[model samples]
Target: MSTLNFRRNTNNFVSGSYDKLIIIWQVYSNNQWYCQQKLNGHSNWILCLLLNNNDDLIISESEDNTIKFWIKQNQWVCQQTITYHTGIVFSLSLNDQQSKVISFSDDYQILLDRKWNVIQKIKVDKYGLRLCFINDNQFIFQSFCQEQMQIYEMDNKTKQYRRMNEITIKCGSNFDHYSFPQQYVKSKCLLVNKNGKSVNLMRKKENGDFIIEKSIEFDDQRIYGQLGQDREYLITWDNKSKEIQIRKCKER
Candidate 1:
Protein backbone atom coordinates (compact mmCIF):
# COMPACT_ATOMS: atom_id res chain seq x y z
CA MET A 1 0.00 0.00 0.00
CA SER A 2 1.30 3.43 -0.89
CA THR A 3 -1.03 5.54 1.28
CA LEU A 4 -3.73 4.93 3.84
CA ASN A 5 -6.34 6.91 5.78
CA PHE A 6 -8.43 5.63 8.65
CA ARG A 7 -11.82 6.85 9.77
CA ARG A 8 -11.60 6.86 13.53
CA ASN A 9 -15.30 6.88 14.26
CA THR A 10 -16.37 4.03 11.96
CA ASN A 11 -13.34 1.73 12.35
CA ASN A 12 -13.07 1.74 8.55
CA PHE A 13 -10.02 2.62 6.54
CA VAL A 14 -9.00 3.24 2.93
CA SER A 15 -5.72 2.41 1.33
CA GLY A 16 -4.14 3.27 -2.01
CA SER A 17 -1.63 1.04 -3.66
CA TYR A 18 1.13 0.91 -6.25
CA ASP A 19 -1.20 -1.21 -8.38
CA LYS A 20 -3.22 1.95 -9.08
CA LEU A 21 -6.17 0.97 -6.97
CA ILE A 22 -7.82 2.22 -3.77
CA ILE A 23 -9.30 -0.28 -1.35
CA ILE A 24 -11.74 0.43 1.41
CA TRP A 25 -11.65 -1.94 4.34
CA GLN A 26 -14.31 -2.57 6.97
CA VAL A 27 -13.37 -3.69 10.43
CA TYR A 28 -15.52 -6.20 12.28
CA SER A 29 -16.01 -6.46 16.02
CA ASN A 30 -13.79 -9.52 16.11
CA ASN A 31 -10.81 -7.42 14.88
CA GLN A 32 -10.87 -8.86 11.38
CA TRP A 33 -10.82 -6.56 8.39
CA TYR A 34 -12.75 -7.24 5.19
CA CYS A 35 -12.61 -5.55 1.86
CA GLN A 36 -15.53 -3.21 1.56
CA GLN A 37 -14.89 -1.70 -1.84
CA LYS A 38 -12.22 -1.28 -4.47
CA LEU A 39 -12.00 2.04 -6.27
CA ASN A 40 -10.28 2.25 -9.63
CA GLY A 41 -9.62 5.48 -11.47
CA HIS A 42 -5.98 6.51 -11.32
CA SER A 43 -3.80 5.37 -14.19
CA ASN A 44 -0.65 5.36 -12.06
CA TRP A 45 0.47 4.73 -8.50
CA ILE A 46 -1.54 6.41 -5.77
CA LEU A 47 0.74 8.73 -3.85
CA CYS A 48 -1.39 10.33 -1.14
CA LEU A 49 -4.85 9.92 0.35
CA LEU A 50 -6.89 12.19 2.66
CA LEU A 51 -10.28 11.56 4.21
CA ASN A 52 -12.42 14.53 5.14
CA ASN A 53 -13.63 15.24 8.69
CA ASN A 54 -16.99 13.65 8.00
CA ASP A 55 -15.41 10.63 6.28
CA ASP A 56 -17.80 11.10 3.37
CA LEU A 57 -15.19 12.59 1.05
CA ILE A 58 -11.85 11.18 -0.06
CA ILE A 59 -9.14 13.05 -1.95
CA SER A 60 -6.40 11.06 -3.58
CA GLU A 61 -3.28 12.15 -5.40
CA SER A 62 -1.60 9.99 -7.98
CA GLU A 63 1.48 9.68 -10.18
CA ASP A 64 -0.81 10.22 -13.15
CA ASN A 65 -0.71 13.97 -12.53
CA THR A 66 -4.29 13.93 -11.32
CA ILE A 67 -6.22 14.35 -8.05
CA LYS A 68 -9.43 12.40 -7.71
CA PHE A 69 -12.26 13.22 -5.33
CA TRP A 70 -14.42 10.30 -4.28
CA ILE A 71 -17.77 10.92 -2.60
CA LYS A 72 -19.65 8.37 -0.55
CA GLN A 73 -23.32 8.03 -1.36
CA ASN A 74 -24.80 4.65 -2.29
CA GLN A 75 -21.20 3.57 -2.70
CA TRP A 76 -17.91 5.42 -3.13
CA VAL A 77 -18.02 7.17 -6.51
CA CYS A 78 -15.66 9.52 -8.27
CA GLN A 79 -17.29 12.92 -8.22
CA GLN A 80 -14.41 14.93 -9.68
CA THR A 81 -10.97 14.55 -11.20
CA ILE A 82 -8.54 17.46 -11.15
CA THR A 83 -5.87 17.43 -13.88
CA TYR A 84 -4.36 20.83 -13.27
CA HIS A 85 -0.96 19.59 -12.34
CA THR A 86 1.35 18.84 -15.23
CA GLY A 87 3.45 16.46 -13.14
CA ILE A 88 2.88 13.92 -10.41
CA VAL A 89 0.70 15.08 -7.55
CA PHE A 90 2.83 14.51 -4.48
CA SER A 91 0.74 15.57 -1.47
CA LEU A 92 -2.77 16.64 -0.49
CA SER A 93 -3.89 18.49 2.69
CA LEU A 94 -7.27 19.69 3.80
CA ASN A 95 -7.70 22.75 5.97
CA ASP A 96 -9.03 22.55 9.54
CA GLN A 97 -12.42 23.99 8.66
CA GLN A 98 -12.73 21.78 5.56
CA SER A 99 -13.23 24.91 3.53
CA LYS A 100 -10.12 24.50 1.40
CA VAL A 101 -7.57 21.96 0.18
CA ILE A 102 -3.96 22.45 -0.78
CA SER A 103 -2.10 20.17 -3.15
CA PHE A 104 1.57 20.10 -4.00
CA SER A 105 2.93 18.76 -7.25
CA ASP A 106 6.16 18.75 -9.21
CA ASP A 107 5.02 21.82 -11.13
CA TYR A 108 2.80 23.90 -8.89
CA GLN A 109 0.97 24.20 -5.57
CA ILE A 110 -2.75 24.49 -6.12
CA LEU A 111 -5.39 25.60 -3.65
CA LEU A 112 -9.02 24.68 -4.00
CA ASP A 113 -12.25 25.67 -2.31
CA ARG A 114 -14.73 23.36 -0.61
CA LYS A 115 -16.47 22.84 -3.92
CA TRP A 116 -13.16 21.60 -5.40
CA ASN A 117 -12.68 24.67 -7.54
CA VAL A 118 -9.14 25.89 -8.10
CA ILE A 119 -8.66 29.21 -6.38
CA GLN A 120 -4.92 29.71 -6.66
CA LYS A 121 -1.88 28.09 -8.17
CA ILE A 122 1.64 29.01 -7.14
CA LYS A 123 4.69 27.85 -9.06
CA VAL A 124 7.17 26.30 -6.66
CA ASP A 125 10.92 26.46 -7.16
CA LYS A 126 11.46 22.95 -5.90
CA TYR A 127 8.97 20.14 -5.69
CA GLY A 128 8.33 19.16 -2.07
CA LEU A 129 7.72 15.68 -0.80
CA ARG A 130 5.17 16.87 1.78
CA LEU A 131 2.95 19.83 2.57
CA CYS A 132 0.34 20.29 5.31
CA PHE A 133 -1.89 22.93 6.83
CA ILE A 134 -0.96 24.00 10.36
CA ASN A 135 -4.27 25.73 10.76
CA ASP A 136 -6.99 27.31 8.71
CA ASN A 137 -4.91 30.20 7.40
CA GLN A 138 -1.36 28.84 7.64
CA PHE A 139 0.57 25.95 6.11
CA ILE A 140 4.08 24.59 5.83
CA PHE A 141 5.74 23.13 2.75
CA GLN A 142 8.95 21.17 2.75
CA SER A 143 11.10 21.65 -0.29
CA PHE A 144 12.99 18.66 -1.68
CA CYS A 145 16.50 18.38 -0.18
CA GLN A 146 16.18 21.79 1.44
CA GLU A 147 17.10 22.42 5.05
CA GLN A 148 14.29 24.86 5.62
CA MET A 149 10.52 24.41 5.44
CA GLN A 150 8.58 27.31 4.00
CA ILE A 151 5.53 28.68 5.76
CA TYR A 152 2.65 30.26 3.92
CA GLU A 153 -0.03 32.42 5.44
CA MET A 154 -3.20 33.89 4.12
CA ASP A 155 -3.14 37.62 3.54
CA ASN A 156 -5.88 39.54 5.24
CA LYS A 157 -6.33 42.07 2.41
CA THR A 158 -6.07 39.86 -0.65
CA LYS A 159 -7.07 36.54 0.96
CA GLN A 160 -4.32 34.87 -1.10
CA TYR A 161 -1.62 32.80 0.51
CA ARG A 162 1.98 34.00 0.41
CA ARG A 163 5.25 32.75 1.77
CA MET A 164 5.72 34.40 5.14
CA ASN A 165 8.63 32.63 6.78
CA GLU A 166 10.64 29.45 7.06
CA ILE A 167 11.59 27.08 9.83
CA THR A 168 14.96 25.35 9.84
CA ILE A 169 14.76 21.55 9.66
CA LYS A 170 17.15 18.66 9.38
CA CYS A 171 17.95 17.17 5.99
CA GLY A 172 20.81 14.77 6.55
CA SER A 173 20.84 13.22 3.07
CA ASN A 174 19.54 13.87 -0.38
CA PHE A 175 18.04 10.41 -0.60
CA ASP A 176 14.25 10.61 -0.39
CA HIS A 177 11.14 8.49 -0.92
CA TYR A 178 7.37 8.74 -1.05
CA SER A 179 6.38 7.54 2.44
CA PHE A 180 6.41 9.40 5.76
CA PRO A 181 4.33 12.35 4.70
CA GLN A 182 4.15 15.37 7.05
CA GLN A 183 1.43 15.08 9.68
CA TYR A 184 0.09 17.68 12.10
CA VAL A 185 -1.72 16.80 15.30
CA LYS A 186 -3.99 19.63 16.28
CA SER A 187 -4.77 18.54 19.81
CA LYS A 188 -1.12 18.51 20.81
CA CYS A 189 0.04 21.28 18.49
CA LEU A 190 2.69 19.05 17.06
CA LEU A 191 4.02 18.34 13.59
CA VAL A 192 5.82 15.17 12.58
CA ASN A 193 7.98 15.43 9.50
CA LYS A 194 10.33 13.04 7.77
CA ASN A 195 13.09 14.70 5.82
CA GLY A 196 15.84 12.58 4.32
CA LYS A 197 17.26 10.38 7.11
CA SER A 198 15.72 12.11 10.11
CA VAL A 199 12.23 12.44 11.54
CA ASN A 200 11.87 15.91 13.00
CA LEU A 201 9.24 16.61 15.61
CA MET A 202 8.17 20.22 15.90
CA ARG A 203 5.87 22.13 18.17
CA LYS A 204 3.72 24.84 16.67
CA LYS A 205 3.33 27.83 18.92
CA GLU A 206 0.32 30.07 19.20
CA ASN A 207 2.24 32.84 17.48
CA GLY A 208 2.70 30.60 14.41
CA ASP A 209 6.36 29.87 15.08
CA PHE A 210 7.62 26.32 15.04
CA ILE A 211 10.12 25.04 17.56
CA ILE A 212 12.02 21.85 16.87
CA GLU A 213 11.37 19.59 19.83
CA LYS A 214 13.20 16.49 18.73
CA SER A 215 15.00 14.92 15.79
CA ILE A 216 15.40 11.18 15.46
CA GLU A 217 17.99 9.98 13.00
CA PHE A 218 18.17 6.57 11.44
CA ASP A 219 20.94 4.84 9.51
CA ASP A 220 18.72 4.46 6.47
CA GLN A 221 16.62 6.94 4.59
CA ARG A 222 13.70 4.53 4.59
CA ILE A 223 12.03 5.55 7.84
CA TYR A 224 8.31 5.13 8.30
CA GLY A 225 6.15 5.75 11.36
CA GLN A 226 3.35 7.77 12.87
CA LEU A 227 2.38 9.48 16.12
CA GLY A 228 -0.17 7.96 18.46
CA GLN A 229 -3.58 9.62 18.66
CA ASP A 230 -3.14 10.32 22.37
CA ARG A 231 0.15 12.16 21.64
CA GLU A 232 2.07 10.00 24.03
CA TYR A 233 4.03 7.66 21.76
CA LEU A 234 5.59 7.40 18.34
CA ILE A 235 6.08 4.09 16.57
CA THR A 236 8.54 3.71 13.76
CA TRP A 237 10.29 1.14 11.59
CA ASP A 238 13.48 1.61 9.59
CA ASN A 239 15.34 -0.47 7.06
CA LYS A 240 18.51 -0.47 9.14
CA SER A 241 16.92 -1.62 12.40
CA LYS A 242 14.53 -4.01 10.69
CA GLU A 243 12.40 -3.84 13.81
CA ILE A 244 9.43 -1.87 14.95
CA GLN A 245 10.47 0.59 17.66
CA ILE A 246 8.23 2.54 19.96
CA ARG A 247 9.32 5.80 21.57
CA LYS A 248 7.43 7.54 24.34
CA CYS A 249 6.86 11.26 24.23
CA LYS A 250 8.56 13.22 27.01
CA GLU A 251 6.63 16.00 28.57
CA ARG A 252 8.43 19.26 28.87
Candidate 2:
Protein backbone atom coordinates (compact mmCIF):
# COMPACT_ATOMS: atom_id res chain seq x y z
CA MET A 1 0.00 0.00 0.00
CA SER A 2 1.19 3.51 -0.85
CA THR A 3 1.16 6.55 1.36
CA LEU A 4 -1.78 8.22 -0.35
CA ASN A 5 -2.58 5.65 -3.04
CA PHE A 6 -2.25 1.88 -3.55
CA ARG A 7 -3.61 -0.11 -6.49
CA ARG A 8 -3.06 -3.29 -8.45
CA ASN A 9 -3.42 -3.71 -12.20
CA THR A 10 -4.26 -7.43 -12.03
CA ASN A 11 -7.62 -7.16 -10.22
CA ASN A 12 -7.80 -3.39 -10.39
CA PHE A 13 -8.21 -3.23 -6.61
CA VAL A 14 -7.13 0.21 -5.44
CA SER A 15 -6.68 1.31 -1.84
CA GLY A 16 -5.57 4.52 -0.14
CA SER A 17 -5.33 5.63 3.49
CA TYR A 18 -5.95 9.02 5.06
CA ASP A 19 -5.49 9.60 8.80
CA LYS A 20 -7.12 6.55 10.46
CA LEU A 21 -9.32 5.51 7.53
CA ILE A 22 -8.13 3.31 4.63
CA ILE A 23 -10.28 3.65 1.50
CA ILE A 24 -10.29 0.91 -1.12
CA TRP A 25 -11.37 1.66 -4.66
CA GLN A 26 -12.29 -0.37 -7.73
CA VAL A 27 -12.13 0.25 -11.43
CA TYR A 28 -15.04 -0.92 -13.54
CA SER A 29 -15.39 -1.65 -17.25
CA ASN A 30 -16.62 1.88 -17.81
CA ASN A 31 -13.03 3.14 -17.29
CA GLN A 32 -13.83 5.00 -14.11
CA TRP A 33 -12.19 5.13 -10.66
CA TYR A 34 -14.42 4.51 -7.65
CA CYS A 35 -14.08 3.55 -4.03
CA GLN A 36 -15.09 0.01 -3.09
CA GLN A 37 -13.87 -0.52 0.48
CA LYS A 38 -12.37 1.30 3.42
CA LEU A 39 -9.94 -0.20 5.95
CA ASN A 40 -9.11 1.32 9.31
CA GLY A 41 -6.00 -0.30 10.66
CA HIS A 42 -2.85 1.80 11.01
CA SER A 43 -2.71 4.73 13.38
CA ASN A 44 0.30 6.50 11.74
CA TRP A 45 1.48 7.81 8.40
CA ILE A 46 2.15 5.24 5.68
CA LEU A 47 5.69 5.85 4.47
CA CYS A 48 6.80 3.05 2.13
CA LEU A 49 4.47 0.77 0.09
CA LEU A 50 5.17 -2.33 -1.96
CA LEU A 51 3.23 -4.94 -3.93
CA ASN A 52 4.80 -8.36 -4.22
CA ASN A 53 6.12 -9.64 -7.54
CA ASN A 54 2.99 -11.75 -8.17
CA ASP A 55 0.69 -8.85 -7.30
CA ASP A 56 -1.12 -11.31 -5.02
CA LEU A 57 0.66 -10.07 -1.87
CA ILE A 58 1.06 -6.55 -0.46
CA ILE A 59 3.55 -5.16 2.07
CA SER A 60 3.76 -1.74 3.61
CA GLU A 61 6.31 0.05 5.89
CA SER A 62 5.21 2.90 8.07
CA GLU A 63 6.85 5.61 10.15
CA ASP A 64 5.98 3.44 13.12
CA ASN A 65 8.77 1.02 12.07
CA THR A 66 6.25 -1.75 11.44
CA ILE A 67 6.01 -3.86 8.30
CA LYS A 68 2.52 -5.13 7.49
CA PHE A 69 2.13 -7.92 4.95
CA TRP A 70 -1.33 -8.71 3.60
CA ILE A 71 -2.72 -11.13 1.09
CA LYS A 72 -5.20 -9.79 -1.44
CA GLN A 73 -8.12 -11.90 -0.21
CA ASN A 74 -7.81 -10.57 3.33
CA GLN A 75 -7.73 -7.16 4.94
CA TRP A 76 -4.43 -5.42 5.78
CA VAL A 77 -3.01 -7.57 8.56
CA CYS A 78 0.39 -7.67 10.16
CA GLN A 79 2.24 -10.62 8.75
CA GLN A 80 5.74 -9.94 10.12
CA THR A 81 7.23 -7.49 12.54
CA ILE A 82 10.67 -6.74 10.99
CA THR A 83 12.35 -5.09 13.95
CA TYR A 84 15.66 -4.89 12.09
CA HIS A 85 16.15 -1.19 12.32
CA THR A 86 16.69 0.81 15.48
CA GLY A 87 15.01 3.87 13.96
CA ILE A 88 12.62 4.59 11.06
CA VAL A 89 12.73 2.57 7.85
CA PHE A 90 13.61 4.88 5.00
CA SER A 91 13.81 2.43 2.11
CA LEU A 92 13.11 -1.22 1.34
CA SER A 93 14.32 -3.39 -1.55
CA LEU A 94 13.69 -7.04 -2.25
CA ASN A 95 15.90 -9.50 -4.06
CA ASP A 96 13.13 -11.80 -5.22
CA GLN A 97 15.67 -13.70 -7.33
CA GLN A 98 17.46 -15.03 -4.26
CA SER A 99 14.39 -14.99 -2.01
CA LYS A 100 15.97 -12.17 -0.02
CA VAL A 101 15.00 -8.65 1.09
CA ILE A 102 17.04 -5.51 1.90
CA SER A 103 16.00 -2.58 4.05
CA PHE A 104 17.94 0.67 4.65
CA SER A 105 17.17 2.89 7.56
CA ASP A 106 17.95 6.37 8.95
CA ASP A 107 20.03 4.54 11.55
CA TYR A 108 22.94 4.21 9.09
CA GLN A 109 22.85 0.46 8.52
CA ILE A 110 21.93 -1.96 5.74
CA LEU A 111 19.81 -5.08 6.37
CA LEU A 112 20.68 -7.67 3.79
CA ASP A 113 18.71 -10.73 2.69
CA ARG A 114 16.30 -10.59 5.62
CA LYS A 115 13.70 -12.78 3.89
CA TRP A 116 15.95 -15.76 3.13
CA ASN A 117 14.85 -17.56 6.34
CA VAL A 118 18.37 -17.05 7.71
CA ILE A 119 19.41 -14.96 10.69
CA GLN A 120 22.07 -12.89 8.94
CA LYS A 121 22.41 -9.12 8.50
CA ILE A 122 25.00 -7.11 6.54
CA LYS A 123 25.86 -3.60 7.67
CA VAL A 124 27.77 -0.93 5.74
CA ASP A 125 29.55 2.29 6.63
CA LYS A 126 27.17 4.99 5.37
CA TYR A 127 23.41 5.11 5.45
CA GLY A 128 22.14 3.59 2.20
CA LEU A 129 18.90 4.93 0.78
CA ARG A 130 18.50 3.95 -2.88
CA LEU A 131 19.58 0.65 -4.39
CA CYS A 132 19.85 -0.80 -7.91
CA PHE A 133 20.46 -4.36 -9.03
CA ILE A 134 23.58 -4.48 -11.16
CA ASN A 135 23.09 -8.13 -11.97
CA ASP A 136 21.38 -11.19 -10.59
CA ASN A 137 24.34 -11.73 -8.26
CA GLN A 138 25.27 -8.13 -7.50
CA PHE A 139 23.63 -4.88 -6.35
CA ILE A 140 24.62 -1.20 -6.37
CA PHE A 141 23.79 0.86 -3.27
CA GLN A 142 24.00 4.60 -2.76
CA SER A 143 24.22 6.54 0.46
CA PHE A 144 23.90 10.29 1.05
CA CYS A 145 26.07 11.61 3.85
CA GLN A 146 27.07 15.18 4.64
CA GLU A 147 26.74 16.43 1.04
CA GLN A 148 28.75 13.49 -0.31
CA MET A 149 27.54 10.45 -2.27
CA GLN A 150 28.88 7.02 -1.33
CA ILE A 151 28.46 4.03 -3.65
CA TYR A 152 28.77 0.42 -2.60
CA GLU A 153 28.65 -2.88 -4.41
CA MET A 154 26.91 -5.80 -2.71
CA ASP A 155 27.35 -9.32 -4.01
CA ASN A 156 25.53 -12.50 -3.03
CA LYS A 157 27.96 -15.34 -2.51
CA THR A 158 27.07 -18.80 -1.28
CA LYS A 159 23.66 -17.44 -0.30
CA GLN A 160 25.33 -14.80 1.85
CA TYR A 161 25.54 -11.07 1.12
CA ARG A 162 28.93 -9.33 1.22
CA ARG A 163 30.20 -5.85 0.53
CA MET A 164 32.63 -6.11 -2.37
CA ASN A 165 33.80 -2.51 -2.64
CA GLU A 166 32.74 1.10 -2.20
CA ILE A 167 33.38 4.35 -4.08
CA THR A 168 32.58 7.97 -3.59
CA ILE A 169 31.26 10.19 -6.34
CA LYS A 170 32.96 13.58 -6.19
CA CYS A 171 30.83 16.42 -4.87
CA GLY A 172 29.96 18.89 -7.59
CA SER A 173 27.31 21.53 -7.87
CA ASN A 174 25.45 20.14 -10.90
CA PHE A 175 26.91 16.68 -11.20
CA ASP A 176 24.16 14.13 -11.79
CA HIS A 177 24.26 10.35 -12.12
CA TYR A 178 22.26 8.88 -15.02
CA SER A 179 21.94 5.12 -15.48
CA PHE A 180 21.81 3.50 -18.91
CA PRO A 181 20.82 -0.12 -19.12
CA GLN A 182 23.26 -2.74 -20.44
CA GLN A 183 20.92 -3.30 -23.39
CA TYR A 184 22.07 0.04 -24.77
CA VAL A 185 25.77 -0.77 -24.31
CA LYS A 186 28.06 -2.72 -22.01
CA SER A 187 29.50 -0.86 -18.97
CA LYS A 188 27.70 2.34 -19.94
CA CYS A 189 27.08 5.04 -17.26
CA LEU A 190 27.03 8.79 -17.70
CA LEU A 191 27.85 11.71 -15.41
CA VAL A 192 27.00 15.12 -16.82
CA ASN A 193 28.45 18.22 -15.19
CA LYS A 194 26.82 21.52 -16.18
CA ASN A 195 29.67 24.07 -16.08
CA GLY A 196 27.81 27.30 -16.74
CA LYS A 197 28.70 27.81 -20.42
CA SER A 198 30.06 24.30 -21.00
CA VAL A 199 28.62 20.79 -20.54
CA ASN A 200 30.97 17.87 -20.02
CA LEU A 201 30.01 14.28 -20.81
CA MET A 202 31.80 11.71 -18.67
CA ARG A 203 31.61 7.96 -19.18
CA LYS A 204 32.40 5.17 -16.72
CA LYS A 205 35.13 2.84 -17.89
CA GLU A 206 35.00 -0.88 -17.38
CA ASN A 207 37.61 -0.48 -14.62
CA GLY A 208 35.21 1.79 -12.69
CA ASP A 209 36.87 5.09 -13.55
CA PHE A 210 35.18 8.23 -14.83
CA ILE A 211 36.64 9.67 -18.05
CA ILE A 212 35.56 12.75 -19.94
CA GLU A 213 34.52 11.68 -23.44
CA LYS A 214 33.40 14.98 -24.93
CA SER A 215 33.12 18.63 -24.03
CA ILE A 216 30.59 21.01 -25.57
CA GLU A 217 31.11 24.63 -24.68
CA PHE A 218 29.13 27.37 -26.35
CA ASP A 219 29.93 31.08 -26.36
CA ASP A 220 26.38 31.85 -25.26
CA GLN A 221 25.45 30.08 -22.05
CA ARG A 222 21.88 29.56 -23.29
CA ILE A 223 22.95 27.51 -26.35
CA TYR A 224 24.21 24.36 -24.59
CA GLY A 225 22.36 21.50 -22.91
CA GLN A 226 22.60 17.77 -22.09
CA LEU A 227 20.08 15.67 -24.00
CA GLY A 228 19.95 12.05 -25.15
CA GLN A 229 18.07 8.81 -24.74
CA ASP A 230 20.66 6.33 -23.44
CA ARG A 231 24.28 7.38 -24.05
CA GLU A 232 23.58 7.93 -27.77
CA TYR A 233 22.15 10.85 -29.75
CA LEU A 234 23.05 13.59 -27.26
CA ILE A 235 21.47 16.83 -28.49
CA THR A 236 22.59 20.14 -27.08
CA TRP A 237 19.47 22.13 -26.45
CA ASP A 238 19.22 25.47 -28.22
CA ASN A 239 19.61 27.78 -25.27
CA LYS A 240 20.10 31.11 -27.11
CA SER A 241 17.32 31.55 -29.64
CA LYS A 242 14.86 29.57 -31.78
CA GLU A 243 17.70 27.87 -33.70
CA ILE A 244 18.01 24.06 -33.36
CA GLN A 245 21.22 22.04 -33.20
CA ILE A 246 21.86 18.28 -33.15
CA ARG A 247 24.91 16.12 -32.41
CA LYS A 248 25.08 12.39 -33.19
CA CYS A 249 27.82 9.91 -32.25
CA LYS A 250 29.17 7.80 -35.10
CA GLU A 251 30.59 4.50 -33.83
CA ARG A 252 34.22 4.21 -34.84
The 10 consecutive residues of candidate 1 with the worst lDDT sum are: 106-115
Highest lDDT scorer: 1
Task: Please give the TM-score that candidate 2 achieves against the real structure.
Answer: 0.56
The Cα error of candidate 2 at residue 247, in Å, is 18
State which candidate has the highest TM-score.
Answer: 1
Clashing pairs in 1: none
C-alpha RMSD by candidate, in order:
1.4, 8.7
Model 2: lDDT of residue 216: 67
Across 1-252, the per-residue lDDT of candidate 1 in tens digits comes to 877778866888999999999999998989999999999999999989989888899999999999999999999999999888888888888989987889888785655555788988877777788889988888889888789999998899998899999889998988777688888999889999989998999998887789999999888888878887677999888988899999998878
Cα error, candidate 2, residue 72 (Å): 2.2
The lDDT of each candidate is: 0.87, 0.50
**Per-residue C-alpha lDDT of model 2 across residues 1-252, encoded as one tens digit per residue:** 334333435545535343534455667899897866665455565555556556655555556665555565655444556666676665555543535556666676666644534245666666544454444455555554223333334443466556666543332233322111111123455555433344555565677654657766554434333345345666555435556567776553
